[model samples]
Each structure stands twice: as structure tokens, then as C-alpha cells.
Target chain A: MVFEEINKKDWEAIATYLSGEMNQQEAVDFEKRVAASKENEAYFKQVKTDWEIMENLKQKNTFDTNKAWGNLYNKMEQDGLLDTKSSINKFKLSRLAEIAAIFVVGILLTTLLYYIVSDTTKKNWQVADTYESPEIRTIKLSDGSVVYLNAESKLYFPEAFEGDVRIVEFEGDGFFEISKNPNKPFIIKAKNAEIRVLGTSFNVNTKAGNDRVEVLVETGKVQLTATKNKSIHKVLEPGFIGTLDNNNIKKEINTDINYMAWKTRTFNFEGVPLKKAVEALNRAYNVNIVCNDDRINNIKLVSPFQNKPLDTVIQVLCELEHLKFEKQGNNIVLMPK
Target chain B: MNLILRRIQKGDLKAFESLFKELYSPLCLYANKYLQDKDKAEETVQDIFYGIWKNREKLDIRVSFKSYLYKAVQNNCLQQIQHHLVEDKYKQYVKSEVAHFHSDPAKEMELQEMNEVIEQTLDSLPERCKEIFSMSRFEGLKYREIAEKLEISTKTVEANMGKALQAFRQNLKQYVGVNS
Candidate 1:
């Protein structure tokens, strides 16, 4: 059995229907054709899906709606919406309520600033703050523990430790030197992984837009667990690291010893290759340094730079290695003298 | 008459947010079709919404809310392209556009794994035919508008569009169950 292929008239009908150009009569005629045969209906649906697939293809995975909302909120704050105390108190702002509130950012910031100012006296108010890095922030928890948030990190905690467990929500990276509490455990909740400790010092690093969260215990014990499956957890002792990379948890010896460089503003590279040293400097200063020469990587460096500026570190490194360095648009290139 | 638009006109932030949630993705997708850069597309859409919010009280809605937003995005994207062209960054624009179009490995694999169905079918289309079809579909240009822009007749535009659609349907016969 042979069936006739859909002709130009049917194609025009599809285009008209799709583009919403069909008048009432034309729409009725097209509907009759579609209703008369399953083939016509199926063809129309296929064309529609094809159009949709193209539209979907146009959507790159980079536009995060939540982050876009955050940016918009920041702009609103700049626009003087949250300036007055009346506006703050009138809305009775909370994060969940702000979602449905007419005044969006003012409500969120009112709740945030209110908690920031009165968090010490008010035991019930929880405070949330987001900090972008290269701007490391020192956060003092009510329990006397201190957290140093790395650049591009968010930390949300209560004004006071209310419950049995002192919990804080995190995204991105931070270093925690938690105060000892025998009865209550300090927990950092990230997107996929949770780190729990009674009292300890450790570094947690998770890159934004990447699905890898790493926790390295510098002192005391740290328990790293999947947020979804608590049973799948790992306990790390000092000098050990646990990583939830691509949904697989692995415990390994902490090799990247300069994880605290972001917080400490210090770097220690002993007998390491120039590549390793350059990588550390790049991370510490958020600068781009490339030494791709065949002979560059083999050069060893044993240097300790403490609390020095980025240019000084580069200058000292260049002097010690007998290399001349040039800067190009936030990037430094080192070549043998 | 969108309830969200009405509420937004009355200076309601929640309704504005609701409107953002509804139209944001479509706007970004539409902008990306022109800009071919995700960050720029997002920024473009964000700026448009920000303007809408800042001037919500006096927003003159001459058309449906959806069409208004779409038109605004189209105008902004065209202005951005013109800006790029003026700065002699049109080469970079084309490169980035090609890179973005080819960047989706998952979509490529899915199109192949679903069957050699949709991916390679368009490779056979003439360059002019493909451009005209895409300008119509992606740019939301009318047949006459496309004809004017391309310096061709409306009849030629329709003929090309019809050929492109027929080619797609013909190649996609097995996938679409055209005969079955």
C-alpha cells in the first residue's frame, strides 16, 4: 500500500498553524484534515516537537535561574527598595516568605541585616550571608568557632546555636577552625556532601559550577557524608582528605598541602617543580601564570612566602630561578634569563 | 490578559517575580538564538526585566505581554549584534556562535543514539535554504521580512521554507512515522 506524501499545501497549513497565522476558517480546515487521519495529527505533533527541540537547543545550560534571581535582587537593593527601616519592619522579611512577597530583595536583606545586627541578642533569628571571593571573610559563630570563607562562597548560620547540633549551610569553599564542643557537633551542609565534626580544623573546597566537594582534615576528625545517602560516609583523620567527586566518595592522603593558602596568604613549596609552585601561586593570587617551556617544569623551587603581596612572590620566584617574567593582562609569563 | 502582568503593573514584586519565572527561560532561549552566547543572553534578558521592574508603573503595554517581552528581547539582541559589528568583533561573534552551536556533545550523542534521525538530516540542505529556514524559525521573522532582508521575493522565501520543511520531514519519515 502506497500513501501520498504531504504536499506544499499541507506544509503551508503546518507553517500557518505553527506561526499562529491561520484564520478561523483556515484553522477549522486544518483541524478537519488532522482529525480525518491519524497520520496528519502525528505529522503535526512531529513538526511541533521538532520546533521545540530547536528551541531547547537554544537553551544553554549556563543560565542558572536562582543565581540570576540573586543578581536581580542585588540590583534591587541598589535601587533603594530596602533603604528604610519601615520598609524592613513592615514586610517582616524572611527568605521563604520573600519568595511570595511583593517586595523581594528588601524582604530578604531586611531579614539578613536584622539578623546580622541583632543576631547576638536574638537567639531565634538565623542569619544568611553570601560572600564572593578573592574577598575571604571571617565569620564568628555564636559558639566561638571561626570560619574563613574563601572567595565565591556562601555561608548561612544562625545568630545563636539553638539546637543540639550547630549546623551551617555552605556552597563553594571555606576553612573551618571550629571551637571544641563535646556535646554538640558542628556540621557544614553543602550541595552534595556534609562535613560533621565535634571540634576540629579543616579545609572544605568545592568549585562553583563543578560537582566536586573536597574536605581535608588538618586537625581533629571530620566525618564526610553524602547529603542524599547518610549511610555512605567517610571519617577522615588529620592530614587525610575525603572527596565527593561525580557522586563517588574516596578517601585519600591530602597531597595539595597548600589548601589553606587562600586563607593564610602564605605558600610553602619545598623541592617541588616550577609547575607545582606556579599552580599554587595561581590559586593563591587568582592570577594566571604559565610556564609551558619544556625546561620550565623540571626547575625545582623550595620557597616559603608568608603574607607577601602577589608581585613580590612572583619577583622572588623569578629572581631565585634566574628567570625574567613579563605580565600580560592578568597573566605572568616566566622565561629563562 | 496575564494576571501576572496586571499585578506587576500595580507595583507588585511577587507578581513580577512570577512573571520572571514564567518568561525568563523563554526570553533567554530566544536571546541566545541571536547572541549565541549564554552569558550575554542572560545579561540581555536580565537587563530587560530590570528595566521592566524599574518602570513597571509606567510600562506601556501596546501588545500582549508575551509579544512585548519577545519584541524587546529581539530589539536588544539586534542592538547587541550591531554593537559587536561596530567594534569589529563580528569575527569573534561568528566564532563564538559556531562554538556554542557545536558545544553540546550530549545533544549530539542523543540525536545520534535516538537514531541517525535528526542530526545529519540538515547537512544536506543548501546553505541558503538552511539560513532562510533558521532566520524564519530562530529569528521569528515573517516571510516578507526575511525576503526583504535577504533581498529575495516573498515567493522565493516561502518556496525555500517549504523545501526545507519537506526535506526535514522526508528525512525524518522513519522517525516521525510519516507513512505508518
Candidate 2:
């Protein structure tokens, strides 16, 4: 029978039969029908082709939720929108508890002295520890806290964390892994804001001349308060972030985790504006990324890179985005299609 | 489709989660066809979902939900490639490790050619037939699975699959004739 002559019921029957849902008699009858006419055979093949195409298309449409969620959590943390204090606190207390309880007092005293001397002896303290430019230096604190100082950034902490509270002052961008000590909360002083954490992984960016201070949390929690006003405190959990300007504080949650990928020598951008991505590339590689075309700068991109060779990255971009680039020494210029 | 649209638009996290789960692998495979990088494809799909969530309030749907999603994925993949071009020029040999993760060029080219043919054939099928065919072949769903997913009887699935296969056979008659 011609395709048009086949009723909907017959179509349904054919579908079932092909699916092997029919009885032996039904299969035999269907086979006979197919053998009876070339038209029937042609129709059957058409349906099969259609099914294959649709199936392929369907497979192409599903998204990986786990990775998506992880990225979201990371983004939120990078943005400083989540409350991470509890986790940080838990991490800190556990570390503190691990140390020999007998020497807790001595360690505490030394930690106190370290913070005091680091803060007071700033100019006199020979750059005993120098982190060269264009490198991230991760320093382990006495309380087991870790600080990831961004390139061209400097941080002053004591030989050991000490006192009722541990405090450190930072310049540029750095991600902190504070060891929780509820009795002595860890505080970071950057520009005009004070970031408090028991123990958490978060980034604080305060580059020179940039009027805003940005904080992002990867795991655990933190509390950020404007140093000028204590009541202006905002709590953050994992996947949460906060940005502080001179007069405003903005909080957002569930950002992509790849935001903090710089610490891992990888940069991930998910639907990031072209301008922002360029800025990140400039910062990470310490080079200039210029978009000559205004339209090109406004386009958004979603991709990840892990220590990718500059040439390969460019090739991928050209092939995938249909865009061109010009390399002028340390400067890379981006142009539109 | 309307229900999914409504749920997605309302910031229903569960709906969003389920939607991602349902579409992730397929979307990645689709992206891989064009980009040739599984990781990039996965990232592109994630970005599309994130974009949908971020701009859900302002979204205006004029086509099937799946169509919109596919288009978005395509756009993101293209944009990612473009951005990489600019950034790659400045940085030195940083991501050599990742470059090695992609399939060899020969395999990629073959897959690309096959994809183009499949796409053309898919476009030529009747609307319902095309949908059912894709649900089977691309999705790797059995006939019963397709019937259950589409809420149709198993017999209908068998009929549609047969019709789809016949269509593909005719459209690709030249290639099939030479090969067979």
C-alpha cells in the first residue's frame, strides 16, 4: 500500500512490529506486506532514516547536569555569593584540633606574634619571602590556612598566625584557604573591606586603581563586611560571590566554578562577555588582548582552557568561532567575522 | 513542550536539573560533530543551559523547545571558537595537554561528512517521521523506548522507524548502491 493509504493505526502497528513488540503472526504478516510492494518497502526505509536522524538529534540536545552544577557552584563561589563560613569554620577547627593539644598555647602565642610583627614591621621586614611577578605563590599559614597570592600581588602575614584573631593584609588578587579557629576568626584586610572566614577557599581581587573589591568562594563559607561599617556584613556559602564598590555591595549566588580556574593555570569562561574574557586572558598571561571590532568585543563565549598552547587556542577559535586574530608581539588583536 | 517552557521560565531548579540531565549527552554529541572536542562540546552545552537560566525571564519562544536549545548550543560553540582565537595568540604553549585529547583528524573528518549527510537526510523526512526517526537512531532508543517516550503505541514506533529507514535508503541511494 502507498504511504498515504496507510491509516494511523497501521502506522502504529508498523512501529510496534519494527520495535519487536508484536507477536510472531503479526511479524510474519508485516514482512509479507513489505515483500508485496516496492512502495511499502520504500516507505519503510524512509521511516527508518527519519528515526535515525531524530535519534541523533535527540542525543545532541542533552546537557551534562553534574558538570553544569559543579560549574555553577564554582561560579557562585568565585562571585562570593554563597555562605561558606560554616564549612571554613569546620575545616579550621578540625585542623586546630589536629595539632598537639599540649603545645596549643605555645603555637597560639607564636601565631599572635607572627601577625603582630608582620603588620607592625612591614617596611623593616626584609622581603624575607618574595613572590616573583607573574606567579601565584601559595603560602601555608601556621593554622594550616593557605593563601594563593596572584601574580604581581604581595601579602604580609606573620611567621606564624597568632593572637585572638588571625589577620592578613593583601594587595592584588589572592585566594585564601583559612584554617578555622572559632575562638580566633581569620580576617583578611584588603582595601576597604574585611573578609572573615573560619576556613574557606575564596578569591579576593583588589588590584591597584580598581575601585571595587571582588570576592568569590569555592568551598566553605565567609563573612565580608565593609571595614568602614561593621553592620554591612554579608555571609557567603559555597558557589556564592560578592562585589564591593565604594558605595555599593552586590551579592549573587551559583556562578560558574571556572571563575577561579586561574589558580589552577586554567581559565574557563561560560557565556562570558568578550570584553571580560579578554580582560581575564590579559591578566593570566600578562599580555594585552585587544578587540579591534566593538561588535567582536561584545560577543559572548563559553569554553575552557588548561594550559593550552597559544597557537592551538587560536586555531580552535578560528575553526570554531569563524573569527580572525592578529598577533602583534605581546598584544593579540581580535576582529569580527 | 509548553509545560517544559513554563517550568524552565519559572526558575524551577528541579525542572532545570532534569532538563539538563535529559539533554546533556545528546547536546555534547551534537556539539562534538561541529567542534570536534568533547570537552568543548560539554562546556558549550553547560553554557547554553546557564544562559537559559540567566535569561529565562526575558526569553521569547517561537519554536519547539528542542529547536531553541539546539540553536543556542550552536551559537555558543561558534562563539567559543572565536574567543579562543583571540586569547590563543597572546598566551604561549599553555594548553598542549588538552589539544592531545581530541580525536585524530581522519576520524573527525569522517564523522563530519557523515553528520552532514545525516543532517540533509533528516531535513527531508516528513515532520513526525523525522521526529520519530531522530528519537530512535540519534537517541539510540529502541522502538519500544521511542513509543514510550513519545507516548505512542509500539506499533507506531515500528512503522515510523521502517518509514525512516526507507526514506534514508532512497535519499542516499547513490552512496548505498556503491557501498552495498
Candidate 3:
């Protein structure tokens, strides 16, 4: 078929070929026709390019659903639209406070509860260590299990394992790379759920105000059970995510694979908006990076920075977007060029 | 929709949060195409969500929640464009709002420039063509899937996608010529 004189069927054929919706015969024919001419090859490349660009834009423009919920929650709170009888309270925490007073209170409550649980349950050797940060903290327990705590996160473990089952409590988010010990099963206690593991590496994230603990397993097998109902449990293997809340326990093959960005610091942003990126970067770096203008968030960054300093990352991002930045007090203020 | 909508109607805030998380990103992106303002787009979607939460008990949706959301965003975006007076002020919406990049800086810049052209070309297509094309391209729907969701035939989806591509090619003729 002539390229310029292509009809509707020809267009369908091309679409199918590009979208991988073609049958074998159609694919062979189309491939042969396109490969026969330089012009055809170029046209095909253009179409492919357009498709790829759209896909990239879709990926990059994906806003944080969690953040979006937080934003909507704020709006609802402002109007008093949230259900008064519901337990899902809105925290309105912006990750940056002069002293993080609410966070401190939360930590205190969590620690107090840890002691109470240890005493009531008749567990031995309870030790709670809270890590607040200018840097991510790596904690090594007596049993050789290592936990990397994100900023403002905490981990409470026993000084020594006194029984066959070892239990630890985690608040906020932490990555655990457990040392393999078959006899001693490891348990993670969070607000709404408990994760039991034989020997595994996983990340547990429990956000404030939301009574849910999200666990993503990196390696090995683990069982996640709701705090209220032990019978409702999910056995999660590697690449699986288990989310336990007051209502239910769910397990799915993880698709949001970049949840480890906080722990790993390996970013893959193709065209993410600046504001969203800053929100995440601020959490990871434990600094205040504010984009005063909403328009600046539209500026996309494709930084795949691995283990880079916050300053260097900010500088590169600013230079790429032609944005100006300077230190203001303890925060970095990004301005339009 | 079945589980969450029921709970939301009964004033379950957590259930409402689940629904919001599922649809927020796509809806915001859809609204942004028309308003060309991220804040406005976000505000528009947020307003709709807030409305849903507030009136959950009396919820009346004829279509699936997914369809209802896309339609709502489309309607809001068109309304914003029609009533929005300061077009020139927001003229830099697409270019200034999004930073486009790939690994190679040169190719990334080219792709970034092409994004504006592609957006313009999309705007020039017929309304239905634009919708079908976007559902396939942005929402990552298969042709048959778009057809089923939009209550159209697969043939129609293919044809509209064709028209969209043909239009894009004609509009970007100059740019393609220089680059390719």
C-alpha cells in the first residue's frame, strides 16, 4: 500500500502493528512493507516515537495518590466534610515543622505502648530506640538483624532474644534485612498489623492518621496479620505487598516498585513535576525544599540520581529547569527564572 | 466501586480515601490538558471529590465510577476553557509547567519541544477523536478496551486513533522535517 494513499484499514494495520495488537500474518506483512523503504521506516519511527512519548508523559505525570488523598483530606477538613463518627482522622502534617511536635507526641505514645505491651504480654528484654534525623539511621540488633530507618522513623527491639520468637516494633517506615536464623522467627509490630517472618528482607511503612501498615517484601516469605484479627492473615513472598488496616488485609503483586526510593535513594524520574519530586526528596533528605509557585511543579526532572547529596541533586535540578534557588533559613527556596 | 462506594455512602472516610487514591492521578492529568494549569486542574478534581464525599449518602452515578470521573473532568476542563479570561497569562502552561527529559540532553530537549506540538495537535482533533486517543495513549487502554469502556466499536477506536496520528503528523511536519 502507498504511504500517502493509506486508507482506514491501512491506518488500523499501522495502529495494530505499533500497539502490538496485530496477528502474525499482519505483522509479517507490515514489517516487510515498512522495511522495504526509507520513507516507510522513517514514518514508522515517528509514530513509535509519538507513542513512546505519550507513555513516558503518562508515567511522569502520575501524581502521588497518597499525596492527592492528603490534599483532598485537607480540603474536606477545611469544610468539615469528613465523617465525624469515623476513626480516620486527618493529621495535616506537612513533613516540615519547627519541632515536629505531633510526631514527637506520636513517638512517645508508641514507646509507651511498646512498654505496656511488653509488660502485659510478659515479653522480656524490651528496648525502644527512636531515630530522628539529619541522616538515615542504620540499627543493628543483637541478633544480627539490620534495620535502616527513614527520617522520623523508629524501631524498638529487645536487647537480646529471650525466646524462640523474636519481636520488634516499627513506626513510620524502615527496611529490614534480616540475618537468616531458622530457629528464631522475627516479628514486626506496627499500629494496625503484625508481620511475622522466618528470614526475609522487607520494608514496612505505617503512616500517621491512617490506621494501616504497608509491607513490601524484597526477599523471602512473611505473614502479615491485622492487629485485631489474627485469623485474617496474608502470606507474602518476594515482590508482593501486604497492606493491613482496621478493615481488611490484602496482598497483591507489587506494581509501585519504587516504594524503596526512600531507603535506596535510587530515583527514576522521567518527567515528574518538581513539587511532587521535592515533597519526596524533602522526606528522604530531611530538609525543607519548597516551590512557592505551583507552576514550577510542571517543570519535569528526569534525574536517576543514586546516593547523591541533597545539595547536588537540587543544583542539578535547578540548572536543568533553569530555576534559581538559595538557602532561606534552614529551607531551600526554589524560584522561577 | 461496589465495596468503597457503599461504605462511602455510609460515611466511611477511609473508604472514600480508597476511592480517591484510585482515581486522583488520572483525573488530575485529564483536567490539566484543558485548563493547562496544574493547580486549577487539581482544584477542579479535588472539588469534585469533595462533592462526592459530602453527598455520598445521596450518590447518583449512572455510569461506572471510572467513566463518571473522566467525563466529569472533561466537562470541567471545557468549562474552564470557555470561561477562563486570562488565556495569555496561562499560554505558557504546557511548556513551563512540564519538564521533559530522557537520558540524552539533546534528545530530551527535542522530546520536550515535541510535547507542546503533540498537545496542540491533540487539541486540533475532533472531540471524540481526542477522547478515544487520550484514553488509549494516556490511560494506557487497549483499543478494544477503549471501545468497550466508551461503548464504541473497536473499529471506531482504531479509526479515531488513525485520525489522531495523521493529524499529529501533518501538524508536526515542519519539526519532523528538521529533526528527522
User: What's the TM-score of every candidate structure?
Assistant: 0.40, 0.47, 0.42
Which lDDT value does model 3 have at A267? 71
- Residue A113 of model 2: what lDDT? 79
Runs of candidate 3 with Cα error greater than 4 angstroms are: A1-133, A250-257, A326-331, B1-180
TM-score of chain B of each: 0.50, 0.47, 0.47
Who wins the DockQ comparison? Answer: 3
- Candidate 1 segments exceeding 4 Å error: A1-135, B1-180
lDDT (Cα, 0-100) at A19 in candidate 2: 52
Candidate 1 vs. true structure, TM-score: 0.40
How good is the docking of model 1, by CAPRI class? Answer: incorrect
lDDT of model number 3: 0.74
Give the lDDT of residue A331 in candidate 2: 81
Of the candidates numbered 2 and 3, which has the greater DockQ value? 3
Docking class of 2: incorrect
Among residues 3 or more apart in sequence or in different chains, the pairs in candidate 1 whose N, CA or C atoms overlap within 3 Å are A132-A152, A133-A151, A133-A152
Candidate lDDT values, in order? 0.72, 0.67, 0.74
Q: Across residues A174-237, which tens digit of lDDT does each residue of candidate 1 receive?
A: 8899999989988888878889999999988786238889898899999998876755888887
* Candidate 3 lDDT over residue span A278-315, tens digit each: 86687677778988887887877777788988878988
